[model samples]
Target: MFKIFKLKENGSDVKTEIIAGLSTFMTMAYILAVNPLILSACGMDFTKVFAATAIASAISCFVMGFYANLPFALSASMGVNAMFAYTICNSMGYSWQWALTATLMEGIIFILLTVTNLREAIVNSIPPNLKKAIGAGVGLFVAYIGLKNGNVIVADDSTITAINSHWFTGTPLLTILGVVITAILMVRNVRGAILIGILIITLLGIPMGETKYAGGSFLPASPYFCEFSFSEIFTNHKTLSDFIIITVTLLYVDMFNTVGTLIACAGKSNMIQKDGSIPRTREALMADAVGTTVGAVFGTSTITTFVESSTGVAEGGRTGLTTIVVGILFLLSLFIEPIFGSIPSAATAAALILVGGMMIEPMKDIDYSDYTELIPAFLTILMMICTSSISDGILFGILSYVLLKAFTGRIKQLQLMTWVVAGLFVIRIIIGILS
Candidate 1:
């Protein structure tokens, strides 16, 4: 069984592989806590979210390790959670059940696209430059989310406002402190710098009473398990629309995020084919879709692959054992909220800031020779920061690319998918403006 799962490669020791896998999972331990909190805030049952996240993480890790044969781990994606909170919940006022339905539908769509090879083609059709821009834009979007959630930035009447506090005498001081500390550790090439930063902030918050520990005993109870419900999604129209938008958003974000992560990890692991394609891309996508669908039905938001898991891969995880270890740890999570809760947002923020920095490297790959690439890239990055949605950044980027190409007599350069995306972007923007 171990051999079938590639738990032990020809020369690699099983113990060593397990160690590597555990280390990788450690980098993402924050998800166990944060994902549930995000979903709970969005009106999901806390117990259900907890169970769903664990199941999703386990399934995602299993698929990534054994089926997809990558070192990546899957969970409720931070980007997707933000979309569920800000767009689906806040903007659209969709219920949590409706949003979960959307996520399941998105997973189904993703699976179909992957099987038909349409997903690959859409990925290919994106100009390399635009892809790089998408990377940078996603980085900014992730950072923006970290800041917003951490209360570093707040909305104001005329414009967005910065707070003044002890860190700044209420001036986003804690946030600044968190960012600077994380950035310094990252610059020093510290492993787990982000986690460390979060720890520091969390500990500090404890003293200031900014955070409280929920003093509950940890144990895997019946509370954390749920079954999939296809009927809840298929029978409702509002649920259907919610599922469509949220699922499309999840699929799109994961598509690009996974592509970027794969390219980078494959380069480091020598997993890329001679032709420069990452082999098993389809399997990986399928695994991601299945994990997410499973996650939603189990009562979580949306499960997608995590780029941060690459930190563990970079540390020497060479086989599926690493991800399997992650899965085991998640199962153990059923009994350990206190340990996970000890982790602070500051530490997670630090890690996010560091990961955000690492993600920006893809921008260097963009072909700046074409103005078409340059313009769309700029717009994508800017929109991500200002509008605070990774999907918006991507949609705007695609729309900008198509509009520019069409107006400049380069209509042939636009893909059919681009037109379809452009139409959706127009509708979304129109609704956003009207709202």
Candidate 2:
């Protein structure tokens, strides 16, 4: 293991990698419960979905470790799964099987792009500010998601969101307390501060009627063994146009998160090539594509490299060994679902909010003095948080950048790839409206 993972070469050993892995897992382990809770609305079995989540996450991390040789980890994605469970499965009237089918198809498309050089072209074309803005945007988006989950914010009749003044009630109070304690831990430079916050809040909530508890078997059937039948690919007799749109939506959204996570996490790890490209670009991206396909087969929503993996990188994980350790932890999650599931959303929300806080350092790299870079970058951050869609934010940013450059007589300076992406974004939007 030492020779294979290059413990000396990467300046990381078994102990350090293990600590980093556990830290990363603790930060993202909320997905063990949150994913099932969200997907259960689609009639998925909670125990089965939990197992699938753990398996998919493990597979993705292993692929990243052995294939990409990066400290990145993967799991069922937050934004895409919300769209998958709520928008596609529930609101759009598609069965969960059909949704997985669309996700599987998207994965295949991502793989094709990786093999064909298109993925590299697209990744190379994105400007630096826009990429940093994508990271900052996801930070805001994650924070927004945490607040929404905690009921710290709620829908308003007039304004889209407003502060929940009734937060002193049941769970929201615990959420506020969690965030405060988590912040204090971070301020004191506590090691594994996020995980410490999660545990402290969880323990604090047990006596307050906040965390739920139920007695059952300590172990559940692994979805790897029991849940295969539910997520097989299936297609309805719906209009071809609707099917096409959903497939495209899934593909675009997955790609957005994958690329954004790659760039942000790589930047944090100082793993970027001198030419401003990520090392092992194809293998890393292919791991994400493979993760999505395998996740669908395992009976779960779309899987992708998670932005929360930055938490591991921040903990001084330098090479694939960190990811390998994470893979082991995810597999262990299968046997401990009951304990993880008992923790309330508020506790997990605190961790996500703190992770977001660490992610904003990228925004400092943006060229805020230049309007050409600033406008598009600002739009990317704004639309991502407001619309809760990373792909939409990137699309608007690219299109606006292209148009502004063209009208400002700087079109000649733009790369051909930018125009191609703008065209694709335009076509997707037209199809969205027409269908």
Candidate 3:
């Protein structure tokens, strides 16, 4: 039975593969909780978001395993969710349903791009330095979110503040402790360290009254389920501009995120060809686009491939089995929210911090040899930290790259598509600023 799904590669053990898949699934289990939380913040129905995530994960995982043949997983996207909540919902005042509709449109656009092989042209046209900058910038932005959400950093009137308190006094302190413990375990090369950290923190929360078992109930009662109004999406023109901006931003972010993740995971899984390219990338992209569209229709934000799945690939997963296991786990979550919800935000915060720390390793890929590269990379990292948006960081990085290259007479070396994308970024920024 295992042979049906297992890779035929020499020296690959089935037992190790299973373990790797489970590890990856555990590392990403936070998504089961985080996805709904983010959508809820956007005033989406929690139940619908949950359903969308499960469906997206199932489709994305199956496609990744069978079609892409790579050890990666896809699900409702994190960065895109943040953009939906912070930019579209908060800044633009779009109803959650309308935001979802925009995401669906973006997903369709992504599918078209993938089908035509434009994804390759677009990715290759990006300067290698800029790509590296985007990766590191996204990592930093996600880490900032982890910190902020964990309440490690709180915003004052004009500055960020850290609450220095004892571990037992509050959840933030507990999160800090959990982060330190998880980091220690990860550095020690312990298997399932992330899951272990979550367990430990959940246990701590239980004792501290931060978590409670929903006695005799299989699923914790969620008050935020399936409450979105699709009619509101079409009727509300007040948020059209916001919807357009978010849709475009998420589309670009999902595109690059999937590209970067596929490349990274392909390298790690040894799925790359001798030329350092992953075959069937278009199929994988199509799967992602489909997943996003499905998610939007089901009432959520964009769905895309997760780079965090690499945490499991690094452990030894090499086939679709890993994603299959993840999908099964996600399906099981519907009946077990109490177990997950019992896990305090502090615990997940720790996991995010640990994951963030691991993600920062990609920074080494940035070419520091050229001043032009270094400046853009630095700007990308800084913008991500300051603006707290991965897309914003990318925009700044690309803009910086184009301006620097143009001034140095190297503009002709860039592709036409590069200039076009850079131009779009400029226009978007101008419109956003003007609005």
Candidate 4:
């Protein structure tokens, strides 16, 4: 297996890779509970969704490690899952089955785009500043996820984002301690610092009642496969536009979120080529695409590359071996669900917020002298943080780039597909308004 993975060639070894994998898993293990919490709102079974989350995550990680030779781990994304349950199902009045159907379609589209290299073309088409901005913006987007998940930041009735300090007594207080401990560990260059922090915070939380001991079953029940709702989806002619919007929205977010994360992770690994493509690019994307297709079939939302894999990279995860370890850990979580399920959100939030802070590392490469470049890039970062939407940030950033270039008589600088993408985003927005 060492020879097969070329661990040394990738500048990694068994011990380091194992540590990296464990680090990555600890950081992202929150999805086990979080995915179920959000998806069960759609009336799905909590235990089943929880089981599906781990299974889907494990499958994707194995595919990525064996096939793509990258260190990134895959899981049900928090933002997209919220959109799946809330926007598509509850608000649009579609069944969860219909939502799953849309996710399947999105996965197929992903495979098509990746195989055709249109995804690569989109990545290369973005200006360097915006690309760096995407990385930085993704960092903020994820940190926003951590804050919201940990209840560090609460929705403000009168303002945009207000600190919920009044309710920061128990879990929230522990969350603060976790972040501080994790940050201190990272600063001190402690090995497995993030994972160690999670373990420590979890132990502390058990006494405070922030982390609960939930009962569990030996195994998830049989016939666990969740199928698409194609028949119902196609029959609803009135919701054709809704279906289109939902599919496209999922596709766009998944695509760019994957792209932004790839940039951040690859940038950290020093894996991006001079021309701005990742090595084993097709395989990595294909693995991600397959994970989504398979995950939707198992009754969850979109599964994409987790940016938290960067935490492992920061811990010296330079090869697919790290990913394989993460994959195995995820599978193990299926049977010993009680142990992992006991960890508090505050623990995972610590790792997430710390990893998110590390995501800004790529921002150093952005060219600050050029206002033309700086303006859109800043907007991308701002919109991403403010809207808490990765795709929305990229969307407005592209629009700004196209409009600015056109107004400045620099249309020649823009790529043809850049213009095309900008126009499509505009059209999508317009249709969204009319519908």
> What is the lDDT of every predicted structure here?
0.67, 0.79, 0.69, 0.84
Candidate 2 lDDT over 1-435, as tens digits, reads 877777788777776677677767876788887898899898777778888889988998999999888888899988678887898878977777777777777788888988897877777788777878887887777778778878889999999999898999767888889889988887887766676787888888888888878444567566733233222333344534566788887777788778777877777777766666778888888888888888888888889887768777766787888888889989876777666668777887777776677777789989988788899999998998888877888987888888878988888868898888788788888877876
lDDT of 3 by residue, 1-435 (tens): 256564665235666566666656655666766888887887766666776677668777777777765667888787778878877777667677567778878988988888898886665666766655665565555566667656777766655555444434667777887888878887898876776777788787777776576433465333223334456655656455555666676777787667666655665455655544466777778888888776766667788887667666656677777776776766776677566556567776676666655556657867788877889888877886786655577677778888888899887867798888788787777766866
Return the TM-score for candidate 4, rounded to 2 decimals.
0.93
Cα RMSD, each candidate: 4.9, 3.1, 4.1, 2.1
lDDT by residue (tens digit), candidate 1, 133-187: 7666666555555565556667767777564233352224555677788778768
Predicted structure with the largest TM-score when compared to the true one: 4
Tens digits of per-residue lDDT for model 4, 1-435: 778788878877888888889989988887887898999898888887887888888899999999988999999987899988888889888999899989989999999988998877777777878878888887777777777768888878898877886546876788889999988988898888888998999999988998887668757543148666777866767777688878887887888778778877887788877876678877888888999998988878999999889879878898888999999998888887788878888888877787788888878888889777888999999998888777788888999989989999888988898887787679768867876
Look at candidate 4 and tell me the lDDT of residue 2.
Answer: 77
Per-candidate TM equals 0.76, 0.89, 0.81, 0.93
> Can you tell me which runs of candidate 4 are displaced by over 4 Å?
166-168
Q: 76 in model 4: Cα distance from truth in Å?
A: 1.3
lDDT of predicted model 2: 0.79
The runs of at least 3 residues in candidate 2 whose Cα sits more than 4 Å from the true structure, single-residue gaps closed, are 7-13, 86-93, 168-170, 222-239
Identify the leading candidate in terms of lDDT. 4
Off by over 4 Å in 3: 1-44, 79-97, 161-168, 214-250, 257-280, 313-318, 430-435
